[model samples]
Target: MSDRPDDTPAPRDADELNEAVSDLGETDTDRLEAVRGRNESLEERLPGDEQLPRTHGSPEKG
Candidate 1:
């Protein structure tokens, strides 16, 4: 049930660990882009302003 593949081997040294962490961060950008794309698609499907929640004063004022 883990997200990582079972075949992935553990990093044995500090350098290996650093490399692994760097690699994971690089992959995260791709995942983030996919999430943003999905969010935009869902926003497009949402109802009009009348059906959506309303805001009070300027959001920056808070």
Candidate 2:
């Protein structure tokens, strides 16, 4: 029942996450939290439960 394709892959680590985030060109706080929640490495690097409105040198909030 998932909308995602069966062939679609889930992010496995911080590198994968960074790549995905980079491609998006915008920070998705909910998605980042969800991924960080599951990925210890990312969680460790990012830390804190608070949402990150911007990341990876993306544009600032105006």
Candidate 3:
């Protein structure tokens, strides 16, 4: 079975399914935050809206 329902086939074995689930657990937070940051940045870039802080990038130098 697959966590996702895209065109791709679902995992056909217990080991493959376990591997996929473990991979999700490992990267869930980082991936979610990245999505959130992109969303915020996009909103901030809209015309007539206040700019939001960027989610990524090196800190500015003094």
Candidate 4:
């Protein structure tokens, strides 16, 4: 048996997936909120909280 429990929710079928989509609401604000949340999560996963400066047209690194 797997160590983790199967308590996680799953889309049993297409109908369930459709229902979830409707429940989630396909709005622009919702999409922006989701993207912001994802960006926050990715930033948190970065090496440090420092924001590096942009170095466009710079020399290639070795």
Q: Give the TM-score comparing model 1 with the true structure, all chains together.
A: 0.38
Cα TM-score per model: 0.38, 0.22, 0.36, 0.38
Q: How many angstroms is residue 62 displaced in model 3 relative to the true structure, after the best TM-score fit?
A: 48
Per-residue lDDT tens digits for candidate 3, residues 5-56, read 7987754798776565564345868666766888899987786623656557
lDDT of 2 by residue, 1-62 (tens): 98999899874898876776674335677667766666977657784535655556768668
lDDT of 4 at 44: 84
Compare candidates 2 and 3 on TM-score and give the better one.
Answer: 3
Can you write out model 1's per-residue Cα lDDT over 1-62, one digit (the tens) per residue? 87888889764898775565573346868656766888899999999987866677555544
lDDT of 4 by residue, 9-34 (tens): 65379887556556444885786687
Where does candidate 1 have its weakest 10-residue lDDT segment? 17-26
lDDT of 3 at 28: 67
What do the candidate models score in CA lDDT, each in turn? 0.72, 0.68, 0.68, 0.68
lDDT measured at residue 50 in model 4 versus the true structure, 0 to 100: 43
Instruction: Name the better of 2 and 4 by TM-score.
Output: 4
Per-residue error (Å), model 1, residue 20: 19
